[model samples]
Target chain A: MNGVRKAQTSPARSRFRDEDLPGYLFMAPWILGFLLFTLGPTLASLGLAFTKFDLLSPPQWIGVDNFTFMFTQDQRFWNALRVTFVYLLLEVPLKLAFALAIAMAMDKGIRGGDLYRALFYVPSLLGGSVAIAVLWRQLFQGDGVVNQVLLWLFGVQGPSWISNPETSLYTLVILAVWQFGSPMIIFLAGLRQIPAELYEAASIDGATRWKQFWRITLPLLAPVLFFNIVFQTIEAFKAFTPAFIISGGTGGPVDSTLFYTLYLYQEAFAHFRMGYASALAWVLLVIIGVCTTLSFLASKYWVFYEDER
Target chain B: MSAEAGPGQVGSEPTIVGVIARHVLLIAGSVLMLYPLLWMLASSFKPEAGIFSNLSLIPPSLNPKNYIDGWNALEVSFSRFYWNSFLIAILVVIGNVMSCSLTAYAFARLRFRGRNILFALMMMTLMLPYHVTLIPQYVLFLNIGWIDTILPLVVPKFLAVDAFFIFLMVQFFRGLPRELDEAAKIDGCGPWRIYWMIILPLSKPVLATAAIFSFLWTWNDFFGPLIYLNDISRYTVPLALRAFVDSTGTSAWGQLFAMSTLAIAPIFLFFLLFQRLIIRGVAMSGLKG
Candidate 1:
């Protein structure tokens, strides 16, 4: 058997080692796909930033014109940036706090914990979809569930959440916060990793429950907390479906829920400003990258990796 | 090993004030989480006029006809939409599992030239906001004539386009014992055999994790289907629901809610059936890694 196998393999073995080939062979499809799809598109998007392509005509070589328009004269660009920043600032912190609080509660050996976790997670899974956004619009509409409940409970009228300019943005913010499950699950996992002995030691040392949580739990869970915050922050900045559906694909009632991605999408697909949208896409990438980097830099002071210190 | 083993033995019953506060907070939070769903169910039974009348958690009377009407009103078959989503989600899950796990296995265990750089590049893909590549991706799909079909939705996953899943699988693979591989090699098994017979079996927990997440994300995905699938017949549930609402100008709230409930039901059923796997998967995929 060995002689026969050797005879069969000798020709190919002389040409190339099988072990060396398998890994590359296994990886070849992925590598090829990434190059053709992601890598090429990334480079093209960057190049398109310098052109004036709109899909209807050949891309004109209008060097720096898109970026120039975006920076020097675009009111809507600034508006989108303003809207997205305000959203990130409010939504990220609120979402983290809500998830952390719920995770802490979940960690306390609460009864029906799994049910609660599943319940909280449902909204997160639903929030990213256009259907949920439609549901949200209905719930917050003038004659929707929210208003009905408000009227029933308090005998007061409620505003049209998707249409009212003053409150429309806040409605989307609430939608963002409602999808806190992913982060909460992370927090719960982080909480589980905090050894019971540390809490015992703290309690034995006369620390109150809150104090133990503040000192032992908070410090130890910092790495996980940091991860949740960074991930949620990026996600919040990418908020699109809710805004798009709620705003009726126009980014109005007065662009109140005009998230950055939604605006970029409009530029690309709606108005066929592919080149200019490409520029906006690049700018958004830089913005997100900078935010993520800043989060990592700030983590040095707070996020407590086990071996890093 | 369990809650019974823990040291929370302070069994003193709380005072009335504490009891009220705790119950109030707990109930309030639970209501906040459950209210929308409850209202959705109730609204689906409410008459068109009753929809915005009381804003109450309870409807005055049930209108079962709304569901019948909603089903009949869709220009395209709703069952076809469900089939589209279901088929695409299954394909995505299977593709993601095989391709992502293979790529992740290579990254996690194999030592090769430029391995670290390639891994870093994969990680960098996660940081690149998806919208940046979405337009170009759309154009590419258009050029390939795959835009009008479900190919755009499922094929990329087969190519391991999802860096997040790859990262997740890499983390899971890293935590596994190296002895498993060595044992397989000593038994004269090749890498593929080891991966198939040993690593894959041991990876059930994380594989379930990847599968459940992929299923949920794929099922809930609207933007990809919305962009590529211009044909109404090819629309997924989310896209179909959007179309349903758009056609009516102000959709019959009761029927719309019913349809929304139907759209959400499959996922809810999935969560119920595999609750344990999902919880474990969510835990493993989180920062505890």
Candidate 2:
């Protein structure tokens, strides 16, 4: 297909020589943006990572000191890292599981599926906003709805979910899980792509529905699942707004909800430790890079692309 | 791996038990998902003292006092925040649709030298977390005195910094039958004319998707406005909403909820009206990426 197009376009190639100016002209905005916003700042941050710069004064060359301090001296750095990983571990699987189950249910051809999907997706639409975060704070307060429900149902007083250090991170995790609509939508689309005949064939062979799911659906859905996992994992890692707002921008109550990005923000803006924050940013970049690379590597074993088959 | 009993197959007239069970589960989950929002809406209409005293979504009385009080609760009236948010979101939508489609058209239809490398770099930007670029971008903007203005938030959109939309439109433009472009070319429609006339008209769905998402994300964005604009008068909805709650002192919970409902109302309405486009966008972007 591509070969034929290339051959056809070969005659147009001569025209493209003249068209090159317009092509680059069309691309001017993105090219300019890439150079200014993405490439330039990325390179600048790399340089800033090696210097001791506060915004008030000029940067002094500090060879590897910021990284050394982050690794050796900053317990909060480790705490932020641990908090982020824990959030990722807890949030991604639970959110995906919730999304998948709801998607499967929706796939069964329920009535008003559109309405249900819309209702289910509303939280995600509003999930990252300051209003939702503020609402979450109120909902999880000691005397809030969550505790009120607990008290009414089980006759037991519940701890302040958002304020307590031990459970604070979980509140954010719950918030993350609540916004499973995006993954659910993707999963639903994936589910629809599975040929109905596959299930019909399995049923004819006396394969139970569960067996058909394991035999047909799971394998077919693996690629979509993998996409959601990697996407959601990266999102979970960079999660800041909920934690930032829930903890009042302090990441406080002994830093329980101190997300990595929030901590980076605090270090850069609050403390004006631009160099250290730059190091933190680079570390985050490396971590995300490593995680994405590992997922792609691991996908070879599990992810089953339809075209590959 | 078959469950004890699977839900009935699609297109085979589902059983009553299956339908009932499905609605039961869906409604249960939907309530859980929507309860917080409902509570907020209910709390917004409740009296100040009644907000925390009860868990009921029903307000004792439908009072407009919270809405009235919250309108001017901040230093600037809530209308200013709404105007700032709407203005920024509209600009962002216009900028993203205009620029991303142009970029996507170039990559999809008009190949130039170094196109492959440039395309790969654009994709890489999708994975690069904003944090890596935040400080330097902030410094760059700061040096240029663009900080505290809407320029930092609005200018990047016009520059097509959002690669997701570019990738989305690329996928869309590639799906367009090449015959149309060829037909246009034979008629002496140059690349620019073909793009503006043929591609843009045929690409309404993706363009609408991009516009909706750009609008939604920009309106809900907190961190950008938070970092760039420090002045209360310049605050967007998200930032202004945050100002309602004074952690140290008394926060007017009813008024906060009132304002929050106002802040989220437009987005909710947008989602309802264009849910199909938004969901399609998510599915397309996720699967393709």
Candidate 3:
């Protein structure tokens, strides 16, 4: 298909002896951006990871010291890693499951599905803002609506989820899970793409609905499900704002909510430890890369594409 | 492998009781989702004493003082923050649309050396975490004295840094038939003329999608402004809202909630106006992602 299109465009392309000039011209801004913003910065950060530079002075060569300290000395680094991973494990699965359940429900041709969808999706739209973070902080406060409702309904007193070190990270996880609307939409789209005839045939063959689900739905939606896993995993790792907002930029309550990126921010911006921050950033890249790689490898066992047949 | 045949059809319990149960689940889920936001919206109008005292969404009596006070409560005021945010968002939208469309047109239509390889590299960057690129980019901007200004936030958009939009536009441009380009070329329309007169005119939906998304993301952005801008006066809405949190004690929850309500009002308006477009954009982008 691509080869045919390329051959067809060759005559039009050869109209100018400088055929690639137009393409090159169009790509000029991106190429410049690639150099100044992406490639240059990426390489420079990698180099800076090896040196001890503050913004105030030239970087001093520090071979493996930063890594040594991070691995051996930094308790907060481990805490950040633990906090981020815990958030990821809880948030991603719960979000995906909730989204999938809702997506499945929406697919049933319920009354006013669009209105229901609109209602469900508003949180994902507004979830990223500081406003929502502030609202979350308020809601999870000791005297906030959550506790109020718990007392009113269950007659049980609730702890201040946002401030208590035991439960602070869980509040952020809950916040992340609430914004399942995007994945829900994706799952809905994937569900819609499945031909209706298959279900019709399955039902005609005396296959029970439960059997149909376990035997059909889960595997067919695997690609979309896998995409959501990878996408939301990356997002959860990069999550900083809510933690920042709720913890008041301190990642406080004894660093229970110290997100990896927030810690990196404190290192780079707060402390001006440029070299250390660069090392931290490189470590983040590796973590994300590892997560992505692991997902893809696991996907080989379950994820199926249409063309594979 | 038989799971590939039929994806979930809501597990189709078509009985009346089943339908009612599903509706109950959905409505309950949506209410659970929207309660916090609606509660915040309702609480924004309440006085400080009434905010937490009443678990109900309704205020005892409507009050606009929170809105009034919150607007001026911050050192720089919410109005200035709104203006700053709008300025940055508008510039970002224009820059992203222009640069991403240009880059996308090149990839979608024109045949060039290393085009395939370059396209692959661009796609790979879609997954490349911004953290890796952030530190050096920050240092670069600091060295160029772009820090504490909107330049660090606004300048990158103009350079087509958003590769996802480029991928999106490429998908769109590929869907346009080659017949029009052929006719334009037959009339001696060169690549530029063909791109401008033929392709772009037929490409409104993709362009609109890109624009709306660019506008929305820039408007809601927190990290970029948090890192780059220093002064409260230059702060965007998100930063300003954070400042309200920092400056005020518990006496000001009313004012904080009020400004927070106002901060998300524009986004809520945008969602109301362009809900379908925005949802479709999310699905489209998610597929690409």
TM-score of chain A of each: 0.91, 0.95, 0.94
Native interface contact recovery, all models: 0.43, 0.71, 0.70
Clashes of 1: 2
Task: Please identify model 3 stretches exceeding 4 Å from their true place.
Answer: A1-18, B1-13
| TM-score (2 decimals) of chain A in model 1 | 0.91
TM-score of model number 1 = 0.92
lDDT of candidate 1 over B163-280, digit per residue (tens): 8888888888888999988787667887688778887898887888888889988998878887889888898999988888888768587788888888888778888888788766
Give me the candidate number with maximum DockQ: 2
Give me the overall lDDT of model 2.
Answer: 0.88
Best by lDDT: 2
Query: What lDDT is reached at residue A77 by model 2?
Result: 100
> Pairs clashing in candidate 3?
A216-B3
Ranking by TM-score: 2, 3, 1
- Candidate 2 lDDT over A142-164, as tens digits, reads 88888888989999999988878
Better of 1 and 2 by lDDT: 2
Error of 2 at B56 (Å): 1.9
lDDT of 3 by residue, A92-180 (tens): 99999999988988784667988988899999997678988999898999998899999999999999998899999999999999999
What's the DockQ for every one of the candidates?
0.42, 0.68, 0.57
Q: TM-scores of all models?
A: 0.92, 0.96, 0.95
